[model samples]
Target: MATDSQLATWEVFIQSKPGANYIHAGSVHASDKQMALQNARDTYTRRGEGTSIWAVPTSEIAASNPDDNDMFFDPANDKMYRMPTFYVMPEGAKAI
Candidate 1:
């Protein structure tokens, strides 16, 4: 029921805990940024459930094209240390 100018889609992410990544809670449809924020609050934070919110326009999120990912990250393999699979934990060390 929204006109083209009035319809906006925002991807909502919520921080559920400290030192945690913002989780993709869901999306919201609203007339503008303010409304989207309020809607996100009602929908995702009704119970004080999150520590933060991020509402990025769905259209503004640029992702690596799947076909291009190979060319993009393949060079990173030259730095194997960037991956930690080989770092064994000291026998008694606990994960931070």
Candidate 2:
């Protein structure tokens, strides 16, 4: 009998252009950072889709709990001034 073990999981982020935001592309499995980067690039940018790539260990990323969405995100709703409705646009100004 043979046993198979998977490599450590890494989270992949890709930027389509310079100065663009790096979005979550997908995940890859590799034993080290360099390998993780190569795997991420090969798997995600096969068609030259990305200009830059970032690979981070899955264990190193901290994410907010989805179950506590109201507790974490609802406070912004109380600040009405943050909304753009209070501002009056000048005549002939294009809508942003």
Candidate 3:
């Protein structure tokens, strides 16, 4: 039950290259998916900056509450195997 004045918010993601990750570019307000895609392109990719674009409705996104960050992320801190501190790098390995 939305009015014409109350456009839905859409989150825009842009990929710079074919194999690169899609990064959050910005957002736009539109009534439908097609409009959202066009608005996102016009608003964020004017310079041909993106190889691909994705426009997702803001209402569809689910996010963790910041207030629960400690409880949510605490388990990972105790998992030592998650970190690579014990791994010895081979000689001449530049960035591993």
Candidate 4:
């Protein structure tokens, strides 16, 4: 059996309402999926602030390095044509 210090870390996400996007809430440490889920709910939803909770293992998440921001995101900066700035609105057209 794994000790408390050796337990896996799970990232927690909370949904405030139905059909709303889940936002990163925090993390919890647990030995298994069920434990992780329960820990997340108990830790983050004590005030009934969340409608739903998702607990994902920390090892399963992939993230980009902050140092690579220019190389990874700079290509989109020069593509001004991708934006719809030149379209003329029709007369009496409702705002979209």
Error of 3 at 49 (Å): 1.3
Over 1-96, each residue of candidate 3 has an lDDT whose tens digit, in order, gives 756476889999999989778999988999999999999999999998998999999989998999999999988988999998897888997656
Superposed on all Cα atoms, model 2 deviates from the true structure by an RMSD in Å of 4.7
Looking at model 4, residue 72 earns an lDDT score of 99
Q: List TM-scores for all candidates, in order.
A: 0.64, 0.77, 0.77, 0.74
- What value does the lDDT take at residue 39 in candidate 3? 96
Q: List the residue pairs that clash in candidate 2.
A: none
Q: Residue 2's C-alpha lDDT in candidate 4?
A: 50
lDDT of 1 by residue, 1-96 (tens): 746675788999999978678999999988778888888989999998898888888899987898997899888979977877797778986753
Scored against the true structure, residue 72 in model 1 reaches a CA lDDT of 97
lDDT of 1 at 34: 87
Clashing pairs in 3: none
Model 1 scores a C-alpha lDDT of 0.86
TM-score of 4: 0.74
